[model samples]
Target: MAVVCSKADWFVTSCSTTLVALNRKQSGEPFVFDCSKAEKKPKESDGDNKSAGEGSEEKDSDRILAFAISASGKHVVLTDDHKRLVLFCTEPSWKCISTRWVVRRCTSLAFTQAEDEVFVADKSGDVYSFSILEPQKVGELKLGHLSMLLDVTLSPDDKYIITADRDEKIRVSFRRSPYNIQAFCLGHTEFVSSLLVPAGHPDWLLSGSGDGTVKVWHYETGRRLHSVDLRKFGLDSENTEKRFAVSRIISSPDGQHVAVQCEGFPSVQLFAVDCGTEGLLNPADTLTLPLSPWDVTFDSQNQLWVLLESEDMNVLLYQHFEQHWRLCDSECPELKRITDALQTQWHLFKDSVELESRFKHLYKVNFDNMASYLQKKQERLDMENKKRAAANGTKPNKKSKTESGAVPHSTS
Candidate 1:
């Protein structure tokens, strides 16, 4: 899938197996790193890990499953479909520092506040911690959940490790002792898909879920600050059979603006974060794109960068001017070059994402057993009432209630 995110002057985007990073200081030159050609550290390749990490590049061998740039924007780490944990340095130059192995296929990646450690969360409900200072060292198991983890993030000060799962729960655990959970930000009725602890707001945490709502929580206390229902804005699920899923939630570098992207929708919803103590959410404006978006993010300059579905000229830069967003793709000199680079492998992203079913089995299938049981009980009551009247040698009245005061069953 195509994805874009930025911190400070660094602009990073990924498609298929290649991640392109463009620093404003290094204009016209985007650092493109392909994971297929990556090499493991010295003597790190052992016998047990030879099958997944070491192999000839097959179809979808190097496809990036999850990736994240560090808080300082100086490093990036990504896990591929082949179970390789690849880390890159960004400040001096975009270079792959390490390619480690994960026990299971990773679902999400996160960096500590110091950016010295990288956290890898897999679909098997386990999270592994890898050292950034010691790139060649193996990873250590940090924590695990009972259900599949969808997103992982840390508090601004690195005090707590927050994780969301397939079971509609957000767990806050101590970073030093993950087994000791701090709190759980509960109330989402479906799987939590994305999480964001906005910049400049250490106490606030923003979460998006398949329940079609965006909620704000005070991470330390696990108190819900506020919530916004996307359905009120007419942002329903494209699949009528399923509930709406908030695919991504991103914030501007200043945390003054938050944008929400729903799965299967071609539009982006923007929310203005208040300056008050509660940091309330107010609807700003919803911008509809021409095509479905693979991902969206905000640049450090507070401009929204949208990676659309189209292959050619897929990158769009929307400038917020005069209280509304205006198209200014031409003004961005790096867009054409980035689009040109992505065009070659656009089909790979399109084909792979199209075939992947993200939210197929998430909806709950409820059986109303109470109603069925009550119906059967009433029928039994009527049958017994009739038998008693027949034994008494008298016609039973249809409206007569039994000694138990149960209503007669309707047979129509």
Candidate 2:
């Protein structure tokens, strides 16, 4: 497929099977012929389009179900319907390099920042990692979630991998040696169809589920940060009910917004996030796409690329600007209390030095650090007791208790 990534004034769309690049630069005759023909397909031919050597068997190798472009845009990793892995590099004039079979239909694929490695998750809950530079598979991690792997993604720092599965489980794994399982985020009651990591925050993960909820988590700590019900987001009403499932989620390049593409919704919905904090998606400021989309991407220029998976199968490029600010939800009392306690504790620590000056330092001690300081003081008391006991020829109470097989009694 010829992936389209354009600026704000330019948009690319497939019109009547023709890939047309439209330019809004000029209002009068604002259309540019970047590539008038969809190069991925050949010109209409009589039923004899398939030659003896180049037939359906070869076309099967050409059809790309899912793909990921390298960060450098030098390589494109693709998986075909036949569970075959392929890489198309620019150096060889768009040639497909068949690497290995994933054994099952691939649900998702991700390329690490290094662009040398690719991670593929199949329907069988098995994740395979391979080097694009090497033909051999490097590693494999199996998540025991007994369902299809909906989406797999690597952390921005490349230190961790996360997979969302049909069993409503999100499995996190360390990227390096042993590939130890980190944490399982479990809240979605149905299949989680999409996994996303925001650009600015390396610790946060987002999963959209068929259960009609979008869940967020701190991947490192396995703490669920937020959960937004799609029904509560106002898309579950009787008249404007959403028929399509959420297929993909993509964060804005600036990390201030997130776009979720659904199967039956109007289009990709853009959501705003609070600045300076890893904010969750809010109900307000939702931007609808031109059509129901299956995949979404925010490119280098901040333009939204939406893949409509209908019969026409046109890729819509939206250049609208979304204000990236999250509106704090007032209903979450627990989160409010936790955030308030944190803020108060933060201010207390910030004013610690000034507070110490108002009273005797007592070895720089205070309630905030009292527990450890008190433990040390108790150790001194225990040592003094031991010395007195030794001088008086008294057996240590702990030792006596052990000998007597009874609990010890000592004030110290």
User: Which candidate comes out best when scored by TM-score?
Assistant: 1
* Pairs with backbone N, CA or C atoms under 3 Å apart (clashes), candidate 2: 244-263, 244-264, 273-326, 274-326
Report residue 314 deviation for candidate 2 (angstroms): 4.0
Q: Judge candidate 2 against the unseen true structure and give its global Cα lDDT, from 0 to 1.
A: 0.57
The positional error of residue 248 in candidate 2, measured at the CA in angstroms, is 1.3
Measured against the true structure, the TM-scores of the candidates, in listed sequence, are 0.82, 0.60
> Per-residue lDDT tens digits of candidate 2, residues 193-216?
778888777788988876666778
Candidate 1 structure quality by residue, lDDT tens digits, 267-341:
899988897859598998998888888889887788888887776657787877887777786646655555665
Please give the distance, in angstroms, between residue 148's alpha carbon in candidate 1 and its true position after superposition: 0.3
Off-target runs (Cα >4 Å) in candidate 2 are 1-63, 91-93, 136-145, 239-244, 288-290, 309-315, 321-412
- Tell me how many residue pairs clash in candidate 2: 4
The per-model lDDT (C-alpha) reads: 0.81, 0.57
